[model samples]
Each structure stands twice: as C-alpha cells, then as structure tokens.
Target: MKSITQLENKKVLVLGLAKSGEAAARLLAKLGAIVTVNDGKAFEENPSAQSLLEEGVKVVCGGHPLELLDENFELMVKNPGIRYDNPMVARALEKEIPVWTEVELAYLVSEAPIIGITGSNGKTTTTTMIADVLNHGGKSGVLSGNIGFPASEVAQSVTNQDTLVMELSSFQLMGIESFHPHIAVITNLMPTHIDYHGSFEEYVAAKWNIQNEMTSDDFIILNFNQDLAKELATQTNAQVVPFSTVEKVDGAYLENGGLYFKGELLMHADELGVPGSHNVENALATIAVAKLSGVSNQAIKETLSSFGGVKHRLQFVDTIDDVKFYNDSKSTNILATQKALSGFDNSKVILIAGGLDRGNEFDELIPDITGLKKMVILGESAPRVKRAADKAGVTYLDAKDVADATRIAFEQASAGDVVLLSPANASWDMYKNFEVRGDEFITTVERLKG
Candidate 1:
C-alpha cells in the first residue's frame, strides 16, 4: 500500500457501520485519524461497534444523535446505502465537511492502479470478466467494490503490480472525491436508484463522476448506444473508448458477427459461453478493458468462451425433462427483466416476476411480456407486474412466494419450455436478498430433478 499522509491527524467520522464503514474506521484510525464510529444499531447488538471500541476508536451507537456532528469532523466516510438526505449527511454537507465513501479511502492508499466499473446492470458480470481476462493474461486483478467485496479491505493488501478491478455503484460514486480510476467504465445507464438519487438525471450524473478526477492519460470507456454516454464522451478529460453491440465504433464493437477491438477481431459472438445480448454488450466492454490492460486476444477469447453467467444472473439451473429453468433473481428492475426476457423465446417462457414496489410502472416490460406462455407474479409488486402482463394480453397466475412461483411456472411449462425467475423488482419485499431468493428457486428446482 502507498504511504499516504493526507488523512493523518485528520478528525474523521465513520458513518453507518456496515462492512464498508467498519473497514474505513479501522483504516482511518491506523492512518492516525481520530476516527469516531457512528451507527444506527444499538451498542449491545453491534459487533462492529464493540470491536472498534476495543481498538481504541470512539463508538457512538443505538442512534445517529445529531449532536455527534458537533465534534467538528474534517471528513465523513459514509456507507454507500445511506441516503444523502440523511440528517447526519445533510448536516455534514451543510457544515462544508468533505463527505466520502470507503471507495475514496481505498483509492488514497492503494499502490495498485484501479479500474472502476459502474452501470444500472451488467456491472457484476462485466467486472468479473475483466478480472478473469486480466488474470488469464498473467496480470493480477483483485475484484472489489459492489461485487460483494469491500475495496477498502482489498486495497490494504494490493501491491503496485496488482490491478484493482472495482464494481462501483452510483451511491458509492456519489461519495467519491479524488477516487479516480485508471480506466473507468460506464457499462450502460438505465433508470435505477431513483429513490436514492431523487432523479434519473442525478443518477446518471453520479455514475459519470467516476471519471471526475481522471486525466488525459486515463481511459474512460463508454457505451456508444446510449445517447447520454455519447454526450458524456464530449465532456470527460480522459480519452474516450466507445463500445457498441449494434454497430462498429472506433473502440470495441461487434461487426461481421465477431467482437473486435480497434478493427482486430478478438472473438466471435457465438464463442461466448454466456447467453443474452446483454452479455454481448458486457463482453464488448470487457474487450476494451482487456486490450487497454495489455491482455492478449487469446486470453480474452478463452475467458469469454468458458465464463458461465454470474450466479443469480440469468444462471442456468436445471433442465428437467427437457424443460430449462433459469434463475435470474438478481434482476431487480424493469430493464433487467427486459434484458432477461429478450434472451429467451418469449413465447416459450414461463416467466416468474414481481417483488418490492419501487413505485415504478411495468410499462417497459410490455414488449417482452407480450407473448410469454405464462406469467407467475408475487410479492408487493405482483399487481403492478400483472397489470403489465394484462396489457400485453398474456395469461397470468398469482403465487404465494418465490418457491410457489417456481412450482407454478414449472407446472405451466411444456417440454422445451423455459421457466425463468426474472423478478422486475427488488427482493426486499419477499426475501432478504436476491441471493436467498435465487437459492430457494435453485433448491426447489433440485427437488423437481429428484
């Protein structure tokens, strides 16, 4: 790790002690910062708070007392999930304190060059692929950020020879100050996290901030298909490398049924192990990162040809009696479900969808939902999803939960049909998370296999 002294002797507040916050608090304390840890959970129940207190860090728990802000902190490291409208955060901003997520801390200390990836969808898959490609080409790529790993923790161990492949969210990006990536990627933007960002424009602006500190020596890869991405290309100080699934671009693109980078055919689209045009877009972006990272074309092709889809992300479960079942529980938005539905023959799909009501209409799913063989809906958003199916003239059934939905979809499927669980809303309404929802679906499918 680089020995940085910017945070030394700084009085910092670590807000909302999730994994990211705890890591940041410890790191800050070690950096000679007078770190004060604050969390909403009670002191008795919070292990992170207990442990930090043992380490000589100040712990304030049970609630976010507004008076804690009176400590005159120089910086505040916030958890990405905490909204900016939060009283503590709002107060800090009002006081002119620099608010940041652990991402900024990771960037400050890491000896490794970072490659940040963010988008409404495909971030996990694209981030994973870039790491795999880089590793296969004899480079060390440490996967971190929102792909179920904390960059702050990972950065502590990364060497100068390593590359930090980070999967960033707009929430994380919103807190960043000087956290610039060597190669930044905006996979594609869709309307998401509107509740957290307050608007789509703000959400896009937050994602665009990944390149805010980038210089001309840095690279910013963009999706040419997105008009906003194209517009952003004209604004960034970094060199722009555009990728497209539809037409050829000067950067990575699809042409003549093959994936190419700067006109050199890297691999054919058919050779990719993962299904869906969405993955195709993901691969194109991965190609840009691989080529820029000095990875050989062979490594890129090998990784793409063998990479099965990410777990709970359009993952193929089981083919029971010739009926294929796909678990896509990670799809928590209309755009995600749209991409999932587009990967299959809509007429042969028994689509299981619905979850938390994010107050967004399912109108976007109309085109993909039009001809599904059967639609099984559940959770708080069931009625909303059903209304979309109804408008599409498709038959629908109501299920009690994910397992029940899985069974209903299977019962409605015919030989050669696909039973896909691509809920178009967040899993919070039904399950703890998408992974739990996906596991239940997979376990139920396994029972059917018996």
Candidate 2:
C-alpha cells in the first residue's frame, strides 16, 4: 500500500469524488484515515461516483453541507477539478484547516525525488518524454499527473528510490504551499484558464507558483523565449536552466534538424519522437530535466530515438486521399493552437476550434491563422471564436457539437488542406472532458473516412 503515515487514521475529507478524489479516499481509508467524499454532482449523473460509494466510502452527493465540512477533518484532499476558492474549502481554511491537492498529497507520500512538468500546452508531452527518458535510462519513474495515473495512483506503489514524474496543472498548483520537486519545468506559458483564474496575471501567477515554492537545491527548467519564463527564471532562487527551440541557451534547443544542449548536439531534432516544432522544444525540456536528474546523455539520446509521442497531442490519425487529419484535442489553450497552426507549413487549414471558453485572449492568435481556409466551430464560444476568425480574415462555419463540427470539417477540407481539431477552450460544454472530446473527434473522423 502507498505510505500515508502523515494521514493514517486521521479524518480526511475527499472533495469532488472524481478519479483523483476517489483514489485519495480509497487510499486514505486503507491507511486508516476516516474518508468521507463530497461532490456537487448527482451520484447517478457521474458514473465514477457510483463505484466509489459502493467501496464503503461515505458520500454526500448533489450538494455540499455545512456540517460535514466544518473543521472536523484535519486535512482536505481536494480534487483538482474543484477550485481553490471553493466555499466549503474556504470555510475549512477559516478554522486554520489545511487543504491538499491529490498531487501534493502524492508528493508527500513519495520518498523519491520528483520531476514535474507544467505549461499552457505540451506539459503531457514533456512529462511523458522525461519519464520515458528516465525509464529507458534504466531508472524507474512513473508518469502521473494530467497525463497518465493521477499522482495519488503513483503514490500507491512508489518506493523511496523510484522517481516520480508528474504533470502539474494550474488548478493543482493553486493550493500547493510547500510541495517541492527536485526537477521542475514550465514547458511554456500562454493564457489559459482565464475563466477559472479571473485575470491573466492571476493565471500566470498560478503557473509561476510551481517555481515559487522551489528551494535552493531544486532545479527549474523553462522556455527562455517566453517573457514570463525569462522573468521568472531571474527571480527563481533555484538553479534556472533555459531551453529553446529557436536558439541554444545554457540548456537545450534545436538546430538544423537536430537537438542541442548548451551548443552540443544531442540528437537529431528532425527525428524527435513527436511531431511539431513544439515537440522538439518539449524534447529539449525533457532532456534538460533528465540530465539534471543525472541521466546520461547516451540514455537520453537512446530514449528519444525510440519513444513514441503521447496520443491526442498532435496525433495524426489517417490521410484520406491527400488531406491530413490531426487531432489536437490536447490543445486546450489559444497559445497551444497557435503553435499547432505554426507547426504545419500548409497555407490553408480547416481549423475546428471552440469549446467551453476559458477567458483566453483570442487576439494573440488572430493574425497567424489567415491560412485558416474555414473553421467549423463548436461548443459555447463558437460565435466568439467565429468573430475572432472573422477579424483575422478567415472563412468560418458553425456546428453545435464535436461530431457535427468534425463532419463539417471533413466537407470543408480539401486534398491538400489540413484539418485540425485544436479547441482553444476547455472541453466541458459538450463532453465529459478533453479526452472524451478528443476521442469523439477521432471517432467522427474515422466515420467520415468511411
């Protein structure tokens, strides 16, 4: 069982009964912590909650209660989906109660050093790549966080010597106070979760918080080209390593179809396991993290040559005749979509963009997507996204859902054009989550092919 000595036999409240929430509850219960779950959604509506309640987890469904959460529990293991400013959690804080994200909880239980990845996009790519590099280098590290297993899941089985590789989201970082990883990376920053964060500064502050909590012995790797990253690097007390795709720095970067670390060629950049210049940058970031962790350059090179990229983050499905169909369901922010659009050399692209709008500024992406042959938009921000496209001088179409938008996307795309499902918003309006949204896009594309 995962070590929960700090929380063992203690009263803990697991908020939001989602995957991570339930996982925390189950582990805590096994460790003798009294676990009670609370979620705002109906038990029947959320399939995950049904199974969780069946496991002897006392659950409060549909709404929160003032009594169950009133400082009775010593610690609150919060699901990342729930906001930091959530009323119930706020109430607990009034009494000096502590709140911990599932990720932070995982960090405490882990006796091993950790590698953390955070960014507007490509965090999963970098996280997976870095973990893969470690594992391939004959070291053991688990891929967890916004990518694979939740950190709670990783904590259940890790040993003191094993490495913990995590992808940290802005939400998960929101509640973190002192949780530190030996190696931390912010792949890049772009305006994301503007709705959840109130302002762009607040959003950036949350992203910067990962580095903010680092101590002197900790190592931070960042994209030097991003102004926010550069500014943060100067201010960080930890050892700051700067990585780039366009230029070489004190760390990794790309050269003529090859990757370089501080001017030394490490691997062929053109042969990076993932597609896009973004992945090249991700590879650079991952390599830099691994090297800092003491992984040899030879192992890093070997891993990059053989590792396949993560699915849904620029995953190319199939080409029907001449058009390429790419699923960037992982592109949950405008900046990520901008990188995706820039990665391709095509002059014309049928961009399927829109989802639950997250307060991202569409202005930054307005100019470059002129090659957007036509955009078949979906979800809550369709009209807003259409207007952005209109202002950018691109043709536009509207659809009500992912499937409908993809259907329209197929019809609008031509032999030489690229069809991209890079929604610059969250995936809650028409789907359960981003994975569901991405899966539905691929399924619809396969149906269109037939």
Number of clashes found in candidate 1: 0
lDDT digits (tens) for residues 197-255 of candidate 2 = 98888988888878766788989998987877888888888899889876668888776
Candidate 2 residue pairs in clash (backbone atoms < 3 Å): 9-32, 258-269
The CA root-mean-square deviation of candidate 1, after full C-alpha superposition on the true structure, stands at 13.5
lDDT for 154 (candidate 2): 71
For candidate 1, list the clashing residue pairs, or say none: none
The TM-score values for the models, in the order shown, are 0.72, 0.68
What are the per-residue Cα lDDT tens digits for candidate 1 across 1-450? 788888899999999886678788998988899999999878875666888999999999999999999989999999887899999999999999999999999999999999999998778779888998999999999988876467888899999999999999899999988898999989999997787899999999999999999999999999998998899899999999999987889999998889999999998999998767888999999999999999998988998998864679887666676577888999999889888875454656899999999888888888778657889999998888888988887899999998998888888888547899999889998789999999999989989878
Task: Score each candidate by Cα lDDT.
Answer: 0.88, 0.77
Off by over 4 Å in 1: 309-450
Q: Give the winner by TM-score.
A: 1
Highest lDDT: which candidate?
A: 1
